[model samples]
Target: MSDTESRLGMPSGAGAWDERSERWLAEGAAGTAGRAGEAASGAEVPRAVPRRGAVDPVKALMHRHRELCERAVDPLEIAAGLEAHGVTDRTAARFRHRDVFSLAEEMFARVPRDGDSQGFPSASPSASASASVGREWGWALWALLPGALCAAAVAGLRLTEGQTRLLVAAAGVLAVGLGLRLALARGPLSRHGAPSAARPATGVWIGWLLGYAALGDGLLRTAATGGPDTLPTGAPDGPWPLATAPLLALALSCAPAAWSARLLAGRARRRLTSSRGLEEFASAVRPLLLGSFALYLGALAALLALCAAVLDEPAGYAPTLALGALLLLARLLTAHGFTHAPAVVLTACASGEAIALAGVFAGRLPGCGFLSVPAEELLDAWGAGSVPALICAAGALTLLIHAGRTLTRASAHAHPTPSP
Candidate 1:
């Protein structure tokens, strides 16, 4: 019998082989006389048979390869298969001259094109639909942005002097809104399995929100320092409202960013914990650098705006403005992409406060001596006005020092001392 038939215990003949086997079995049972007769007649003893089927060798190899790649099984069988096929002399030889996992990935990557023959789904219109929806949502966010600005402009016209009571009332409302958001955020987050990265992102987002709040708070403090008469002062007055309005809007916008950071940080932390120590530290540093760059750019924009308003020759300021703006935006985008660090948070806050100071100084400086009020009154106004600017400057300096320390520490880690 052939090797396959012998192994399977099956007759290697037509369907009539069953009858022949039965006859042989009968003949073999006839004892010594029959044994002598059988030897003369060239008869053979019979046995029960088993079923067999052809198993596709390639498909089995692919399945086993997948199992090994997924770490679901030992790779010994796969190695044996390769050796059996003479694909390599040694069972220890690498398959396809590549890591099993990498080979598996490549193999599966091409499977979709095989149209289900390789057990992969073909590309479909659903993917295109998702892409379309994402595009629409992105465009929609910016579509009504101008309308919101217009509304803020119209509202500013009515918020003139003697509206100090109204301004205080607005502050009260903002405080309440923020408080509600905080209270709501507390419940879910307290029980969350959120990751460490999320914490930093949360810190960064909170920092950004705080930065905007700091800007508005600084402006309010500056306005308050001017007394009731100093109302409607600063930055096209309309633009000031725009700036302030965006703070609330930005605070709300930060929610999504914070949540995203939390999810990402958690994933990153898990991945890093399993990795080499150096790689883990490098991963964390990426976000800090990114956040730092963003804060820098935003600060730069505010500075340029102040320069444009306050300087005599503003023509040459455009390039500086553009560069600063790009840098700030780049910083934000990069920080958001990577792991957020506390340093980036502090950096952003400091940059924002500095920009705000520039704005306040721009609006208040020249007018210091040119007020319609008496010279003595002008001196008093300068003294009062300087209070807010000084506070802002102090805050900016604090944040800058904090961020600087973090950056320095990070730098130190990146360049460890060598042992003699």
Candidate 2:
């Protein structure tokens, strides 16, 4: 096996993740077709029609390469896998230098001329008639989209301010509906297993946006301290949202939120590449994160509702927002791609939170003022917002290290081998 395979093992017995990850980047993950764009669309190879009754020459050629991807870390390993997969000794000798991506490009270029070869039924007369009708309907819809949008905007401009706002909102809804229709029209990306990386991650900050917009103005209004003893950097009282910096910070920090959740919550699975242990562990922990997040949200909502019922004003502004930030930051941490056991990473997160909370209490760390709304003129306790800030600090450090390692490997792949 390749020397890099050993790096898949961690400094300790984190299992063989080091070897797994090394294999992942070296030639892409096993049993994974690269992204659709990278596969058929991106390749610059010649597209040639297959001969009648002929084998898919390209697919036949790639069979051994895919088989070798399982346990082949080095030339010797690949040769062994190739032989075991029924490649003649002469054939194996000729393929010793073949790169995986090059082989895939060739496979992409091969177009099976018959429907049976590509596993599609031949078009019947009725099916052909329906396809033509569908084509006409598509062109008609395409022609109507822009005109409808212009009419909506024109109608909105002639309405009263309040009515205009409603009209604009309706138009926005229509636009989203149109976008969804177009995306669905594109069909699925691929037929077989798409590698984990092939899946696109959406941002989950929309929920945060809705929550912040609904309560933000009140949250900031309640947090303003008139006391002279207040720190110079503390949030000043105003109708406008508190410090704009936190908004930007949260936006960037939570950009990866959805992606992380997908990884932790078992949304993405590396079927061919990752070990069974890693997969099972990920599958198990995902539910814990999901259930934890759900329970936290339910409790937070109920607490806020209770506060509203008891107090006349925005009562849960401080603790509710603080805890909400903590929940999101914690979810983000779970997606941090720990190489070893999930337990070790979870431990680090818990310890880091404790240490960070201590630092904040001692005035060693800056506060997340935007999220830390105050119940009174002053807060005597370190607000729970410190948990998220501290968690973010730790996650940022680890992510930086991961990025550096990735860059180093890319440099090696570009030139020679990287340093271990």
The lDDT leader among the candidates is: 1
- Give the CA lDDT, 0 to 100, for residue 416 in model 1: 11
lDDT (C-alpha, whole model) for all candidates: 0.36, 0.35
Q: Tens digits of per-residue lDDT for model 1 on 1-420? A: 332112212223333333543444455445445446766887784432211112323323443333221221122223322322333322212333333223333334422121322232445689968966774454334323433443343244335544563574355445534443342233111112111123444444444443333244335445435523444343334323323333333323333333333343344444333332223434564565455445443544454454334332222222233322322232233332222343454455446545544444445567653332332242356532243334334434444344333332211221111111
List clashing residue pairs in candidate 1: 197-265, 198-262, 287-339, 293-331, 294-331, 294-332, 297-328
Over the full model, what C-alpha lDDT does candidate 2 score relative to the true structure?
Answer: 0.35
Error of 2 at 83 (Å): 19
RMSD of 2: 20.1
**Residues forming the 10-long window of minimal summed lDDT in candidate 2:** 189-198
lDDT of 1: 0.36
**How well is each residue in 294-411 modelled by candidate 2, as lDDT tens digits?**
5544544554554344322333344344434453533333223222322333345445444433333334225644333332212335443433334434544453344333211211
Q: After superposition, how far is residue 379 of candidate 2 from its true place, in Å?
A: 16
